[model samples]
Target: MNSLNSPWAAHFIQTGAGNNQSFEQAGALTLENIKTLFAECDKPYSGLPPSALKKAIYSSDLSQVQPLEKVIEQTNRLIAKNSIMVQHPHCIAHLHTPPLISSVMAEFYIAALNQSMDSWDQASSATFLEQFIVDWLVQTFSLGADADGVFTSGGTQSNLMGLLLARDWFANTHSQHNIQQDGLPEYGHKMRIICSDKSHFTVQKSASLMGLGERAVVCVKTNQQGQMDIDELQQTIEALTAQDLLPIAVVATAGTTDHGAIDDLHGIVTLCRQYGLWSHIDGAYGGALMLSEKHKYRLKGIESADSVSVDFHKLFYQTISCGALLVKDKSNFSSLLYHADYLNREGDELPNLVDKSIATTKRFDALKMFMTLKSVGAQTLGEMYDKLIELSAQVADSVKENDHFELCCEPLLSTVLFRLSSHYQGSLSSGEFNQLHQTLRLQLLTSGDAVIAETKVNGKLYLKFTLLNPCLTLSDFDSLFAKIESHAKLLTNKAL
Candidate 1:
């Protein structure tokens, strides 16, 4: 068999799979490729239907597939044909952003090496590297003395780890037995978790997975800006106590997903301490802001948390599928530890990561993060954080200055919510107002000139922009708003 004729071999040769490109050269290549793909970058949409797009991708018949060179051409065409460009400055939806270019190159190395940090024997050097990065993150956050953690897929997994640990800790302390072996029989069903209404939905999902019912997550109210109200939190805890429910943990969010609002961390920490509740800070979205000394103050008292969740992909400039759950005590892994003779033959073996994580085979995600921080230095990353926050403020200013849009909330971190201004403020029926907001969002998506986000607030439609790209400037917002306004006017015309 001619190896050159093998599709896999042909693909590798065609794409230079085994060849490494220097950072400078790769970056230039990426830029050139991007320019070539998006020839008319200013176009509003790709103008391709879902069926047509699927047909194009599925056109590749492996049984009679063309040479790998043709596949590369198709791949480039796919990139050029999509409107979902997170790297573009005008993409202002959700927490999406352009990851650092250097980290992207590091990701290539990680993928090629394919290090699985499941156990020491399988990934000795990779395991140690991951451990070192985790230790550094623990120290950086000042989690606690002898704190430990592991990299995860993302915020949802990290959040789940925190909840799982909290559940095990509560179980072990109350039951005087191992929950992993004995289950939650000793602790009973009185255990519950608590978070603010603005907290990520993952908290509730995590609770349900931890054997606590979805209703077990008590929702504390928040202030006007979406910051969790300390008074309401305390009252909720007290009410739960009166009902004889054990409050297992308090989950404080450093940045709520909707508006990037930082909770009253100092106050929340104090209350957690007073109540003897395990405190977990869901800083997955905002934890990277700790890199910036100027804005680190917003996360004051976060150091008091028993555990913290941080997503490197969110702002650490790492690619997607990178997050961490840091614990104050190294021994917290005891609850999750599992042993088997076949896999645990080495007496001096370092702990298997599967014992610590929810998954068995985990990617070497720490490589990208470690390389990114080392290559760019913490100072540069911090500066990038500051720049994005400042850029978000600039976006808000643009919104306020324009007669077409209004600022819905003060950006507590790097998110801005606003909506098109309308004189039809005369209380339209709720149904009518919601209908308008829905129409506005659909209009923007179909336009595709500028990507935006929408979320419901107190039954009102609100457009949102999550600015996490340092490369974007206020001028980007000018175009973003101009497109939004143009589309919104069309909606208004249809309504009339």
Candidate 2:
């Protein structure tokens, strides 16, 4: 028999005729495994400890095929022991959320169909549906009829896309410099993207990737709450202009990482207009505020941004890796559009998604959001976010009342930053104080009863509560805080 035509080789091809029976069994088993794992998410740390995982992983044989029942049971057990239980109220770490059941169902379908979004031919109806979703998002931003966007991996990719288009458009608009073709023009080395010091680090990374050094990201001073100081930004722009440096874009962060501070969007956009700079908003965390009737006003000038990036996974309650980059004017995407004979041809009109995005062979992650909105409705999600925000405020109040803790700032969106105040009475230095807070975070993680993020503000360590779980209540937070304070005192006593 020919090697290619042999049953063994053909079964690996993934075509229905070759592997349909095997695929069906595997798919069913995987779904059942997921259900079993998800059922155990009430625990703070559902995963096994490091030592046990290492032992099991070393013993497992990948080369041998196991029975379907055995495989399913083993997979479910491994997942239950290893996965972070986001659904648990005490697991309020990072910007992660327990994905909605409706959206999880959508994810299963998205995976099963395996729709790729690069071109028209690969995902015919899916391509249009993605476009429809993009249109809906653009409308939500009130970005006008000419607005367009593409789904990305997450905030990082979306932010990269935002800056990439801005970089090219700025080059072309200013001096007819074709950034894509010319590599970097004479002054491209001096290209600057200004944003708050509190802005996400992705901006500086994007600058570095774009051949503009990290120094090209000029940091404007932020206020106590972390919003950019417009006066300082103006002064910095003037100083840079005096130095003959070119300003490519102004990246206004809608929600900062550590502080969750929303920069003055209207103020930032106004500056961009004056400086002839493209405005980009990294609304990755706070962008879901648009869904809220009560808080949509917070992002007042987001409509004026040249481009905006928002993540569905963060606050919009979708699963991981669902984000979009929206441009005010669809023509901005032309900078990235490329033509190929077999894929996105020049003459064809079937919505070639590859034209607007940096990625090819993209996942249909947008379907998760689409299904979420269709089933749960936007208002419902907004209310969920509002509830979390409210819960964060209660946590903040609890922190303030406790002498063992110090609130860093008022709760903005859903994140709360605070730190320990060990009454150790050992003439402790500030650096020692910082170390105690770090120890507190580590202790909690090792205990596996709670999960919370830790970040620094102004070179000082602070504990964080990123409350993306709407199901959590003040009682859950009370328990987590008690754990935190008790753990800190225990560490302090150990030091004594």
Q: What overall lDDT goes with each candidate model? A: 0.79, 0.85
lDDT of each residue in 60-164, candidate 2, tens digit only: 889999666687788677755576778878888798888888788888778778888998889988898889999999999999988999999999999999999
TM-scores, one per candidate: 0.91, 0.94
- CA lDDT of 99 in candidate 2? 87
Candidate 1 residue spans exceeding 4 A from truth: 1-35, 38-40, 43-45, 55-63, 424-428
TM-score of predicted structure 1: 0.91
- Clash pairs, model 2 backbone: 47-81, 47-82, 48-81
| TM-score, model 2 to reference | 0.94
User: How many pairs of residues in model 2 come into backbone collision?
Assistant: 3
Model 1 over residues 270-373: C-alpha lDDT tens digits? 89889878888999889887899899988998887888899988888778878898998878877877776655555754757777877888898888888887
